[model samples]
Target: MTELVPTPNNCVLPRIRADFATFNDAIDYAAKSEKGMNFHDMRGTLTRVYPYSEMRADAVQMAYRLVDAGIGKADRVALIAETGPDFAALFCACTLAGAWPVPLPLPTTFGGKDSYIDQLSVQLQSADPKVLIYPPEIAEMAAAAAERQGCEGVDWDTFAQRPAPEVELPKADPEDICYLQYSSGSTRFPQGVAVTHAALLHNLYGHAASMDIGNNDRVVSWLPWYHDMGLVGCFLSLIANQVSADYLKTEHFARRPLAWLDLISRNEGTTLSYSPTFGYDICARRISSQSNVEERFDLSRWRTAGNGADMIRPDVMQNFVNAFSAAGFKASAFTPSYGLAEATLAVTVMPPGEGISVELVEEERLSGTRRDLSRPARYRAIVNCGKPLPDMDVEIRGENGEVKSHHQIGKVWCRGPSVMHSYFRNQEATDECLVPSEDGKGAWLDTGDMGYVDAKGYLFIVGRAKDMIIINGKNHWPQDIEWAVEQLPGFNHGDIAAFAVETENGEEAPAVLVHCRVSDPDERVKLRDEIRDKVRAITGMNCVVELVPPRTLPRTSSGKLSRAKAKKLYLSGEIEPFRLAA
Candidate 1:
């Protein structure tokens, strides 16, 4: 047996070692080692019939064509297309050419076309890409965006027309930048995190090792390509490990949640899939609407159902599992992982094969005092994000740069091969995130999140240290309070921002301002009361709930809520104040 060595163009397949004197022996070994099946454009009605081999070949050809089109090492290529074969091919092509791909989301995720264009403009200016490749339908929009940013736009058809070149691929160094992943920028402007080829490979290897992914595994996922989880977790990991995979359109899944489950059941997908909070919501809604929903899809084959990209709620996971349990879905399949674009994708994944693990502590203890993983009864349920990946190290440090002992809450700092090189050309911003070691020796990336590691080495995320609300000497995660309030009727799904506000005398109290889409004034008042009551019941904390018009809640360019800006508007009196019933 010989090992397969990866050239710059192709991801090296995992290999075994043997005494081989010639390169031919390694090539022969790679050929016989059983390459995994790969698929692109596994969406709409085409997934049932698309050949896996054809997709891989097409992607390789696309890579060569992109190289011939002057996209070579270090060149930046912008992708503004939907999730399908085209996007996957472009991504692979960029990777093969050693060019960095900047994937921007389609306009559909936001409320309107103008908003999308505005966000895209900002990204285009910051990335300063050489070419913009997009689908034919959106060619005009891409052209307009490129023209506005002083760049060229190439339609997919034209981009694909370039002949595949026969040039020898360069050897890629592990430290060379691979892709530029744009952050959601919920609290600030969007910034691009420059992840290196080494980082990407490290994460893929880490994920494969942790999940026990093999060539025989088949992945079914509907996550958007623009998202880090979708690209690195589902697409790249499948390619690097040579596993078969099927991709559904993110919008299609949103419109028809059953399609996501159907793809899994039909393909018998054995490993790999992910979604955010809204995905669970959509699935639960569809399952509740139909009779015998459980019998419709057998999900017993699913190995890792990764829940990430948003705040993970124990209630949401439990509800989704309960809804699909009748269909042979296992509760253990729900893996509560934690990650961000800066880490390429995953920093920690819940240990596979184990059922959902959680710790319940007292709310008062969690709010009034430090984190106590030992005081199980004093805190509410906090799901474990599992241990760090094999190649990574995690530490919890306080504001003074001292490491906290186990069970003490503090900012999370991580150092590993998977960490991004830096934010693209933004030294100040990068410096803020990638902090120096306390001893001034090495570098560690600050996660901007507050959490602690348990005695057993399981990590539990409390919340964003910046987003924590301090009211009357007690701390509260705005997400917990926000989730409680959002459960009330009449509160729009994306129209709530909760934060702590300081009064004239400098006393801090929780302030929840919700954007009520409903028009009836009486109903809005009732909804506010219901929200307040729910928050009080859950946390024993009194909150000021204010109801405003729809779309009043501020959001980032990526559509995530901007709590900091919301608070600023409230203090400046730009946001209307709501009064409680006298």
Candidate 2:
């Protein structure tokens, strides 16, 4: 048997050019370097080494084939965002062929086959892609969705073998649309974010500059390619910046969460990796009681552990540090960031070495409510999401569209080259969020997220404005209820989802759906009571608590809790709760 050798982390090529004019140009330059992408299997074993040079040649072939097939400039081509060479090369090929590649999500564990088909069909209708390409493993479902949308669907492997007569590929201009990305919370009628080559490159520049991507830096990622962070930061940024990277399939990481660390341990060079807070929570729980964290892992060289895509939990971050401190993981390496799909990827990233800095703000301030003199003030920990990216303007706007003062939490508004041009084919939705700035310089995007910037210019996220549960003129964040229940014995993150629902009397009240694992009938009743009591203590009023089977709660494609969908399912009678013994 031959030995396995991963791609080198550094190359002798004189680094990136001044800057890439377009993503296609970035790909052309990266192909000249020796650095490339390394693929790992489920158990952290090296499986394939995909060199940039070879990827470029393959992409060019596919580009010619795309042109021959009548796929031309600005044509939309949908592709299942799988973590593999076929998808990678095909994505690059789309840019080379001057088509907007739409990166759609793979079927997640939360949604079944029919659910996944419905999701794909909705997105296909929105994107109106000329074709939908996917891996053969999911051919049946992919083809079904494509057929429903009246579009052609083919597996990437077979498409790769299609004849390619030499044909002139269309030129990709900097202002041309680079790709289409849908946000994670897209259960119905989701608008696609249309990003241009110029916007994509500018965001990449900001992301790279903020992180200070060093010469010795290598990235290890398990984030799904469908999300903005994974697609732009880890995948596209690496190419445009001419850096080497290693990847583990998101599904494999789900099965063995610690394999992400194991793969990182095998790489001795300094590394940058990212995930939402749940990723760290999973790994820490996986090795919490174990004593071999230091023995099995060498995380001494891990330079950056990025946390984003959700609200950063400091308690979870602290728990991770306690579990991995023995493994040489530093608390200073946690780089929490804040961004959205509408911004192309990153708006603010904490500088390296400035780990998690949390501020204790009154819960009422977070919800913009009057202090209740009857009860002691409750404080919520808001993590500092760091400063704005270069050329990215950050502002907090009140309900009247006026800019708020420091420590004032409101809608997070940003304007920059990286902000998406528009939502595909949705003029009303575009006009809803992208309002013109008072300065008349550029349009500012209302992020729909509630946050504030401090005196030092570090941003702090409160929560999503849409997820707030308002009852009787008082506001309550769903996380406040969910976190309170998670304090009980058998609860974990994502195990509880909280939202607002109307009572039989048409009065609004907080409703919580918890993933219960207790089997005994009496114990289930007792557990439900305990959860209700816990939530009531937090809300100062009784909440509707339902105990559902474990994993019944739905997750977004990026694995974040889908409170909106969970509420929808519960109301629609799809998620039946266990009946309590009377």
Candidate 3:
């Protein structure tokens, strides 16, 4: 017996019309082809190959099972979005049942069971899920969370075994809700962005057209399925475009970051993969000491290496390109993109082969400081996150809600057919951010991001609007201070969190929370002082520096540092800091 080779690089399937009214339509069309998803392990070995035909079959059965279990159209079905066939089938099953599938993050990285349960309870309360499906491995935590939310938690095995009663499946309409995508919570608390079928399809079409995605492209991803990039971009986009995809669990990738590239190397097709800055940074650092990287990996076929989810770090991307260029990697393959869950994943994408273009804006301008004509301009390299996708409009709005000129940094806003209907059950948040466009044709979504667009239409994100620090009437970005501290030898990426704290007199002061690995008291004190001085030099103001144990900082579900959560923890004295002399 011989093992069958997976979908070959050159074997192109018949392209499906991407104008589907709903995700079920796309999946129905894709079920005609043998091309499907393959799951790989850290060793680059194929674990499972699930074709669309089987997936749809299982999903239909699951849909019947769900309907039998009293789940109906428009009902909320929550699933712990682990990267596997069960979750995939259940997600699509919800579509067939005309129910809204809400993806909840897995409980692997949240440190302890209680914290995971708390987080899960919060989301469950927000979603008000009719049923919570999770792998049996996490039954303890899942059961607790479900109980707290007054919902039933069913393991996948039990759910699969449920009786599929003969009932008519609810038909989906174009205007119906497609799914609920939770924002990554990098800056603020996570909110479920309500995406409709029409909006999702439009976004998918625009994304496919923007990337020029064809049958030749294959997707390889380790991003968590709960994230928009992983759920919409990698998963839904593949089904819509009839492209084959390879997946490794996000947890597996964390333990073996190089496996993502290895899977891409093993697949001869032109690979399309996206990751946040830390993903690339981790891979580069892990493999820096290894030799024969060229022989071990073949990144020549990787055509589009996408960067998003957090601030795009040019230095980290450069390191990755340089590290793998010997393996036929091209610098031009880098695609820095800008998006949020509110827009259903992609707002703008760098054209293929354009690489990453950056603007060296004066530091003061980046921080929203009024220019001093006589001061020497210190520049910061802001990565250009390409043009908006078709039908997507990008605008920079000033503090007064007026549209800003090109290169003038302000809050980023977008309006398009793909923009979300609203934040689920959070009218206050929706009202605060979503507003009517100038022409009153459609609503504009306040992205809550600070950025500017160049004359050529490339967008450069500066920082989070809520995270900006203002001192003595001058604006400063926390990322600027964090990035400067990252340049030190002992510090690695993601070792710092910067924010603003109010003093006893109600004056705002910049605060820095650094993850220190050094155990020596004197060295820790020196490190704190050095960080404080560095921040002061940049902002020209006193900053409070606190040294905390490594890995003490809070992170959002999508793995970006949650500065807002960190600030809350610090202010509440939950984050115990090491004693350091001022």
Candidate 4:
């Protein structure tokens, strides 16, 4: 395997347009250039080098074939989103065919066959796809899921063999629905976020313009295609801006994360990349086990190292920078931002070259508890997720639906053209969160996240509103508690889940579920006591700490620990507690 896959001569950057009416229109112009996408493996080997011209041609053929297969405009085409050439081709084909492509999650590491099948069945039922498509590797599970949904399942090889229709292809309009993106569903069942071409284009334009994206910018990513950030930010953004991108599958990154950096090191062009806090932490830890860190990679050209899809941790970012600085990695390249599936992808992006900036807020101010002026003050570091994109509005809403001031934490609400049209087929869910704005120009999406903006307009997230633990009248973010426990030895991220449970007296008390790897009864009991002490020290509340076997905690498709599901399983007695036999 070659260390570097040389960029094609024709992949030279082009003059980016201000905006496009639709993604198809964007791709149509991008195809005029040679810039395209490259997919790599865990060994940093380039498996496929797909240019825009070939992709456009292949997509056109696939679009006509789908038409011949009896698919019509606005019909749902369910795609098992894996990072590869087939999924990309089929996604573009659906756009050109004027059909709504619903990108569904691939099987996760946590879920077994049955769990995956159930998840697939739920999404297929909601999407009501005309046809289901998947890679051959998971043909059995995909076929079973399609059978449950009563839809025809076709693998990539079979789908490619179909003949194209001998007729003019349908074109997609700006107002037409582009695709359905199911949210990460960390706290609840996944709902399909209906994104239109106009909304998607608007967000893409904002993303490019906000970052001042130029011809020199190149993207490298391992984010999953099913998620909004990976699909819109990495895949579609490159097409719309006529920039080249390199990709490693999410699973590959999990096994050999250094390969991602190695790929970047070999590429000379200006690099732009993004990941959650965990991504950075794991890579830094892996570096400790290997030698020759400085000579193996060159990250000086990586200008924009974005952090999103989860809370941005300053300590983790600092560790990564320190570990890789010898190899020319800059701490100033970190761009912490915030967004969700509903906003299409990005709501706020830190300007290029600004790095990661954060503010220190008093603990009482952050937790909504009264501070005793006589006591010594303590502060928590909240990373600043830069200003909102041009024309987007963000506000902090209090419990009464009134907006809050700066430094005041509340539910984060946003209004912008880039927001989704609605939650498909779920009016109740849509109405529960989406509300009209005062100006009546557009509606505000209740992000269901709690955060506040500083005077400089940078957003700072606290935690999920629903996940905030309330004991008496004070609020405590679960992540803060979880992070505190994670600081202990022999623990890692996603190993702890915290929530509020009602006591026998009907008062809310914090309960913690820790994934215990200790076997000895004495050590297990000691670990439990340590966790309780940690929680009590932080929040001043006695928390019930229960230990469970490792890997027993539930997780979302994107590998995020699902606190809601954990709580449900614990309440129902499905998650058995770890006990030492006397």
Q: Pick the candidate with the highest lDDT.
A: 2
For candidate 1, the TM-score is: 0.74
Lowest lDDT block of 10, candidate 2: 468-477
By TM-score rank, best first, the candidates go 2, 3, 4, 1
- Using lDDT as the yardstick, the better of models 1 and 4 is 4
Better of 1 and 2 by lDDT: 2
TM-score of each: 0.74, 0.83, 0.82, 0.81
Off by over 4 Å in 1: 1-44, 48-64, 163-165, 184-188, 364-379, 438-442, 465-576, 580-582
- lDDT tens digits, residue span 243-361, model 3: 88889998898889899888888888857888887788888888899888999999987888988877776877888987888988899999989887789888999998999888787
Model 2, residue 283: C-alpha shift (Å):
0.5
Clashes by residue pair, model 3: none
Query: For residues 1-582, could you state the per-residue lDDT of candidate 4 as single tens digits?
Result: 555443553444455643888989987988888788888888878878898878899899999999999998889999999998899999999999898998887876653676578768878888889999999999999999999999999998899998886678777788889999875332124578999999998998898887777777788899888877788888888888788888899989988988889988987784788887778888898997777888898998888898887667788899898899999999989988888878998999898889888788887786666889899998878888899998899999997899999878999999999899999999998998899888898999998888998888888887755676645323456776788799899999999999987678544578999999988999988888888887776566688888999999999999999998898789869999887442
All-Cα superposition RMSD per candidate = 10.2, 9.3, 9.4, 9.3
In model 1, the worst 10-residue window by lDDT is: 18-27
lDDT for model 1 comes to 0.70
Give lDDT per model, in order.
0.70, 0.86, 0.83, 0.84
Q: Cα miss at 541, model 2 (Å)?
A: 25
